[model samples]
Target: MPRLVAKGRSHFPFLALELLTFPPAHRSDFWSPICLQVSAAAFQPAARSSLLEPWCRSSAEPETRGPGPRAMEQQHLASSSALRDTEEPASCSGVKEEVTSCSFNSPLFQQEDKNGITYRIPALLYVPPTHTFLAFAEKRSTSRDVDSLHLVLRRGLRTGHSVQWGPMESVMEATLPGHRSMNPCPVWDQKRGYVYLFFICVQNHVTECHQIVLGRNAARLCLICSQDAGCSWSEVRDLTEEVAGSEMKHWATFAVGPGHGIQLQSGRLIIPAYAYYFSHRLFCFPCKARPHSLMIYSDDFGVTWHHGSPIQNLVTVECQVAEVTRTAGHPVLYCSARTPNRRRAEALSSDCGEYFEAQSLSQQLCEPPHGCQGSVVSFRPLMIPNRSQNVRDKSAPSVQQSPLLDGLLKPEEVAGAPSETWLLYSHPTNKKRRVDLGIYLNQNPLEAACWSHPWILHYGPSGYSDLAAVGDEGLFGCLFECGTNQECEQIVFRLFTDQEILSYVQKD
Candidate 1:
């Protein structure tokens, strides 16, 4: 049975008394009226803007007027303001962005034309915060400047702050009291509260050989400090005479090696030293076996010293050792070298700072054709959590594809493990080997399967010096020399954060 109902009002005739009523339509037609009613109700407010004034003037409602010229102008002004806000400049909108992003820093190389010949070498330790002190040998044709050694103190602007440091003071003048000319290498010792400067004084020149022109007659280690926060250093005390037979030519390079002279668990002080032979005559050829690497230990800080057995690996000169505890096992001393081969060499020492293994780890990557100097840091592996249950299932061997595996009930599952090792060094060029930073990662030492292609951190039209890790502040700082020519008038130290490295990885 079908159901029907009355819809509209019922009317009665006045005179004849007749009644009229409207009946509902079919259910299919019923929706038509309802849809029309809903659409009209929705559009009433929108239509009222245009129709309201006409309705108000024509009807008994109070008279209302449409917008005047002034109101229309104000409305247009408001619209323009809204559009302007939408198109605001990016810098003013508080969106952080990089000024320039690249993997390498540049000015890849530089050479200075002083006197008759061109002498272009990478400027060492020019950056401000990381480069506390820098020392290098410079030769001039004229006697006025002469063949002199120069040292510079680093200074620059922090990202959000301003600070200035004075020019680097001359240490060779005061330290080499008797000799007027000397070549020096300076290193700062935070633990000993002094800067240790090493230099070789010319004993006498050999006119016959011409090779032994700069034979080291005397080697002196000075303990220097400045009261004005390293601005002006006081006179260096002669610490060389304190060592036994200190007057004799020891022929060594002093470095603050592994442990940074921290009081050990055994209550002993460990300082690392390496012995090497340098000659102006042998400058073009490779180094001989005479120069070797050695370690020195002091029980009462620098007050007393005992020389340890020399490391058997004497293949490289300018060696550097870093104390690191990478895995859970034990802390090991890692050594790196800038050898004559134009490649970096590494070795590990198991014994407690006394002796190291003979075999070396070679990074076969191409180094700049000239002399190189840099450092390495061993960072812990960064682990990412796996949340999928199918990870193990996906790692299983494909039984369907292999006949040998199909016979077995279950296949073996191999999970990829995570491990990271990083190496940083200066990249050199053919004409002038400017200092630049390169990073490489590996799970195993010198193993291609575990290694990554080298990535450049900062290289530009300028060169970077040595890099230092400020663990306390989580910053990797570098000294950079920005000059059109090799002679850099202004040097600055710049700081980059750990987040920058992570961001680089993400982009790659």
Candidate 2:
């Protein structure tokens, strides 16, 4: 018999059920009686035997060949245990009639808000002196005074408790011309200490039937700077003509074309921008003759750019690119986007963002089926040991074993393993729209480890709008809303560890 332990008093009726199994020889032992503190009027003697018999069954055969029955029972319990200690009325009729087992094998911490819309769109992440900055668009309804475009900062976690970085600043106002709607794509440049915000703004529009008819004005990429470590931001400046009028049109309303800017090892900055055309006139094909994702290179930062056509024979929109530095001495470019088939897909490139392979990896991610923005970042190794040997140990092995590794030593060890790539996108799974964070070990960039189970960072009635990682650890992400209502009024910036992300799926 198993024992029941109650830690505190319960104001409402509580049900305690325990299932235990013993060796066949010990089946004759009487289980300990569970103490009940119910009033005499509320107790019924006849119902006790039926409820207790299920808990008393110890004859079920354990599966020794595979996972034992206890392990299986624990899995069932963890997945089904939704009991909340509240005063809400219990709906016994809706509860499933099956019993679940539980185990304390895995642990995960998930924080979710029930009222906000979530987005998987990509944003620019930067860590300045006092705060972590995340820049993205918050799409709002057309009826509102202005479409919501924002740049939010949360306080960096340096000491004890973390706090919001800025006062949750908003950059969407009427003072700026061509600031009609929110732009979903933003990129940060730490070397130059600036953030390049790209968006498709509308001008020369007429109002029709209570709707503001928008025309394709020139797309603008604005550079905003914070000289005082993100405390005070400078006025936005136009980079369209400065970069030689490389502004593109909107392919899809949700598609913020080409927002990734990667500084390659060759000191050349490769920035991707797409050419798209949108018409509210509603033809047979809503999006027509849009050039696929395009790339442009700059030798002198953003002063000037050399344009390149879309890469040949690849079909994707709103693509993002990041450089992956393997533990080995090779660098690769990883690109992720929404496929033409409306699936979240990814591809790789050996040459610096100049050309990409036609094929994508086998494991498909749960991104928005339709076009949505996403971002990818390469994480640097946490610890790098010194290579200089002392004069006395010059002839010793180049690498020293950690003292913490008592007897766990292998003869042959793999060196220079590539750093893991974290892919953040919105995908629909288990009938719930969630933002799935997947980590791919870059042993072979084409095929990720089969054990790479994606975990849910946030889940609720809403989906993810955008994601950006702050600082060297690349743990926390600032997310945005996906809907057009500007429903994400309260900006939420969360800090999470990789261990916490993996624990969500491993919980027993």
Candidate 3:
């Protein structure tokens, strides 16, 4: 049996059930004032398991897959009806939030009469200062990475509970003369008010496997900055030699994010990345390659950056970072990544992203066959809506009223701030394939087992995704690839509120 552990703390009263089968495990931490132990059985679906039987049958047949992008014409759709009906209602029905979704990119979208264009690898960044949401993707002639031509973007503004997004445009300036641009990773500097878009430019038609086989690095690290949200961008700057330095000699290839990065409370910027390095044999003949997730960070704002050491033990790739604060002073950098182990691998860094300590596997967050890129963002835990706000009870207090939340608090929360840091993660929920996109919550982000069972976001043909915390009013956004027969047919955006998330995780 798999074991799910949540170490540290005194009272884990409101602890959520993990989506895995294992006995509850708890460890004590001196700095943390709350600890939780809950059974995995609480999350097991009841007789309603049959409601998901159609998925397995449909997923096996291409012709019987979900309806295509055209069926999603009605943008204002409710959260998965299948879920709402099959699962027991977790909260009062009155304040339940409606999920607003829209197809931002599809073959149906005409650009100068162009058709059959495939967009993939989504990255979303939310600028709090301007209340702006920037959605980035690669413009591909075909679904293959080698066919990636350039980067494209869409800007949105938070309007009430929904978002009003503008038109899609290509980041024409984010390219080199003789290369193709892929992976549109965006990192916003909150303190400096600058939007840094980092990506890799590969020599035309050159694939990653080609570089790994020859032990050569064909991808160049490049970035473009914007001062006015994403309306305009500066020229691309090649940071390969500057940041990677002599390290490139041993790396077969490397890539940054393909998702958003984070800025810590200390004004430091960290971009999650990974590199495939050569494992040599005698005479260094036939170099073998292995992937490891690392970080590229800057302490003096975005002026200069240095790469950190990769996780040495297990192979990991395509990652995102978030800073979690404990009850005792000081913050820990949390790194979540895609791994071949079929389970999400997490690592922590006490000294920012320079180096990572112990690595743990999140048994509940299982991945597909080869693994898929996921996104994670950290935010202050929103106060659970009170009974006056149509909620079920008033006995459950906010993070402020309970000692159970001490371990989850941020540095500011320790200084009498109102809320603690919580994490929201988005990825494909299926273990057999990349379908059924879902979102998982971690109220106590410092612990690996604190993750709640995923609340399925899209029920079919879903892959590569990015999550952004929309403003601070308990709103979030997800941009992912989904379609009827295949995931690459359309890039869809969904807006959901904290109430919807909390209701699902706290349900009986």
Query: Between candidates 1 and 3, which one is better according to TM-score?
Result: 3
Ranking by TM-score: 3, 2, 1
TM-score leader: 3
lDDT of 3 by residue, 1-508 (tens): 4433323221221112232443345222311221111112232112111111110111112212565453353222421311112222211222222223332222212222123467778888988876778888888775556667999887765546545455577899999988999888899898889999999998985556445434557899998999988888999999999889988877877889989988888998888988877655212212445678999988998888899999877778788989877656678788888876689888777779887866767656797765778899888755844422321223333332222223333436444432267788998888887777888887765432456778777667677899988656888888887765566666777777787888887782
Q: Which candidate number maximizes lDDT?
A: 3
On lDDT, the stronger of 1 and 3 is 3
- Give the Å error, residue 154, model 2: 6.0
Write one digit per residue (lDDT tens) for candidate 2, span 1-508.
Answer: 4443322322111222223444566434533222122212223211101111111101111101222454345334334433222222212122221111121111111112322222222344544443444434333322121222333232222221222222233444212574543343444555666544554443323111011112233344555545444445666655555553433333322123323466666666666554433433321122233325555566665556555445444445556666765544446666665443445556555566666644342333444333334455555434432323111122334444322112322313223342344344333232212222233222123223222344433232222334444445635453432111122222233445544544443341
Report, for every candidate in turn, its global Cα lDDT versus the true structure.
0.34, 0.37, 0.66
lDDT (C-alpha) at residue 288 in model 2? 32
State model 3's lDDT: 0.66
Clash tally, candidates in order:
18, 23, 7
Considering only N, C-alpha and C atoms within 3 Å, which residue pairs clash in candidate 3?
8-27, 9-33, 9-34, 9-35, 10-33, 10-34, 10-35
* Angstrom error at residue 412, model 1: 23
For all predicted structures, in order, the TM-scores are 0.52, 0.55, 0.74
lDDT of 3 at 283: 25
